[model samples]
Target: TSEDSEPWHIYTDLGYYSVELIAESQNCGADTLLIDSIIHVLNPSFISTIGNQDISIFPNPVKDKLYINFNKNLNNPMLLNIYDLNGKIIAQKDILSVAPGILELTFNRNKTQKGTYILRIQNTEETIFETKFILN
Candidate 1:
């Protein structure tokens, strides 16, 4: 039920399930909180992949500009989103047009606090890739 001091992850078969979290104070009779949510799990096969697109992001400990490169012949537009460790979106871009070899994008870094962040690339329908990076 527990791993390292990090977040707890629960993986289950495809189904609708309700999960609850209980937090209690040190005092046995102290205040407690109950947090709950409904979780829906879809079959992995349904979301494994629709099309293949190779992606790469560089200058990980980026100073100003974070560059992203993609490899594939994509006709439809793709969206790139960057999020801070707290899951807040910090930057986003839509690749409106490109030829059939590779596409590249750059996000300007300004006043962004130094920390870890997540990079996600997706289409309107599904998320294709996600990775982590650092800002310095």
Candidate 2:
């Protein structure tokens, strides 16, 4: 039999048995018995920290294509600006109409040195969100 909090015993018809105990407390009950198995409930909200902005980037150490997802529709034109660590603007693009969804941007890694760079996204009003990536 399986249980969330241990102290499990397995017995055979031949009179042989083995026991195992997990030194933890179960919130359900201390003396709860499991003839077969027990199921444990999980709270999903405790699994991850979901934020407000809800923007994400993938393939962090990106070589070419970088994708972004925005949680909400943007009122102003979104601006993407890429910069090297030295504060020099390498590339800039003004996205005219961005629906609330995922977007893709491609970078030529061949033109970029293998190092860390910063990607900044802003709106017409200059509210900015920044993320860092490495070229390898």
Candidate 3:
């Protein structure tokens, strides 16, 4: 594709991607010319509405446990909940005192079916962060 070409719309999972563009010619002395580009797709399910810019999660297609990291803490009881696709609550937990650091939690995959689910992190009054995850 050339610079005047329109942008391509592609839907993909969270991961690193590398793309290459090549131009081939038969009459010219050169056989081909190539250029490369890279991109990273972050999980869109992870969103924070409380202005918490340091929240992040890893291992989108988690097998057992997902790692969540927050550079700053909300200083409140963080309510963590997992819900199925039908809006049914599958698991929930309440952390009374969350330190201004990383937190590790385990996910039991045996209780729920293998599919996409929603993970919500919030307080008693409002939601702070919400993201989607897949259980295998």
lDDT of 2 by residue, 7-114 (tens): 322222233233333334566544433333332223211112123266777777777877888777666777888887679998898887667788888877677766
Per-model clash counts, in order, read 0, 0, 1
Q: In model 3, what lDDT does residue 131 have? A: 76
Q: Which one wins on TM-score?
A: 3
What Cα-based lDDT does every candidate model obtain?
Answer: 0.62, 0.63, 0.68
Local accuracy of candidate 1 as per-residue lDDT tens digits, 4-112: 3444343436776665444455677545344444766673112122334466667666766676665655667778788875689988888764454544444455557
**TM-score against truth, every candidate:** 0.53, 0.56, 0.58
**Worst ten in a row by lDDT for model 2:** 40-49
Q: Which clashing pairs does model 3 show?
A: 45-131
In candidate 2, the residue pairs with backbone N, CA or C atoms under 3 Å apart (3 or more residues apart, or in different chains) clash, namely none
Worst 10 residues of 3 by lDDT: 2-11
Question: What lDDT is reached at residue 56 by model 3?
Answer: 72
Per-candidate Cα RMSD to the true structure, in Å, reads 7.7, 17.5, 11.3
The sequence of per-residue lDDT tens digits that candidate 3 reaches over residues 1-136 is 4543443423356776666554455776444433443666774334323435677777777787777788775678888888875789988888886656777767765666666778788877878787777665
